[model samples]
Target: MGALGKENKDLTGVAIGISVLINVIGTFFFPRLLMVSGKEYGPAIIYGDYKNIWVYILSPILGAVSARILYKFLEVTKPAKPEPWHCNICNHNHLPFF
Candidate 1:
């Protein structure tokens, strides 16, 4: 739950794709163009200074949301297993028995 042990490649790709899609949509809708001084999109983003800073601020939020979705999906598909060491008395196993 803390660090997401391991995620499948497909799941990671999906998350990245979703993040890109969200950012692209935001670009079309948000006021990113207004901040464009000169050069391409990437340079313009770094160059301009906006009080709100929607794109720079919101991209991370989208990425985080995508990552969270991917994590939840992995959790749903992940296999459940018993702990390696079994208790002799009660026939129970500690979570980190291994």
Candidate 2:
């Protein structure tokens, strides 16, 4: 197994944490995407009050699970090294995301 460096570990952890927060906030926003016509489409689905609770609850659970799964992927992928670059626009070494 490839060992994660401190920066990667910290970055991954922060990403996971942010995902958790987004999922929590999304509980309110996502159900809004549901549309009702006695049919589910077109962004007008009315969430029953109980469904609201269900959504807020399940979303975070799923988010945490997804984060865990993503972490597993992170563990498997090799960390990329920053490439050295010289920029005429500015004098400094820089790396761009590939």
Candidate 3:
């Protein structure tokens, strides 16, 4: 249902933005170095390529888009509403959710 109207876009956009922001913030918490076998060590930031930044920036957007497409295809927004006593929607049917 488009009952949300204009609020839908605003809410969804902010949600996507917030998720991406959290991912970016988490990137900073990544260990700068990796300890191997508790003896040897190496750089944790793999490849050390600035271009890899795009992967971090774009992955959330891509994932969100894919999830939206999947949800629409699965008709999650317009689910089959059964009687309260008979409702039994199983998560197993929706494999790999997000």
lDDT of 3 by residue, 31-81 (tens): 432212121112224545454355445655797698788646644243455
Question: Which lDDT values do the candidates have, in the order given?
Answer: 0.60, 0.59, 0.50
> Ten residues in a row with the worst lDDT in model 1?
31-40
For model 3, give the RMSD to the true fold.
Answer: 16.4
The global Cα lDDT (0 to 1) of model 1 is: 0.60
TM-score for all predictions?
Answer: 0.40, 0.37, 0.30
Highest-scoring model, TM-score = 1
RMSD for each of the candidates: 7.7, 14.5, 16.4
How far is 15's C-alpha from truth in model 2 (Å)? 1.0
Model 1, 1-98: lDDT tens digits are: 46544545546677678756766776688645333323344554687745555555575678579767967765745667865677788898656635
Error (Å) of candidate 1 at residue 70 is 6.3
Stronger candidate by lDDT (1 vs 2)? 1
Residue 91 of model 3 has an lDDT of: 27
Candidates in descending TM-score order:
1, 2, 3
Q: Is candidate 2 or candidate 3 better by TM-score?
A: 2
Quickly count the clashes in candidate 2.
5
lDDT of 2 by residue, 29-96 (tens): 76553222233322234443343345544655786698679877766455678888987788987787
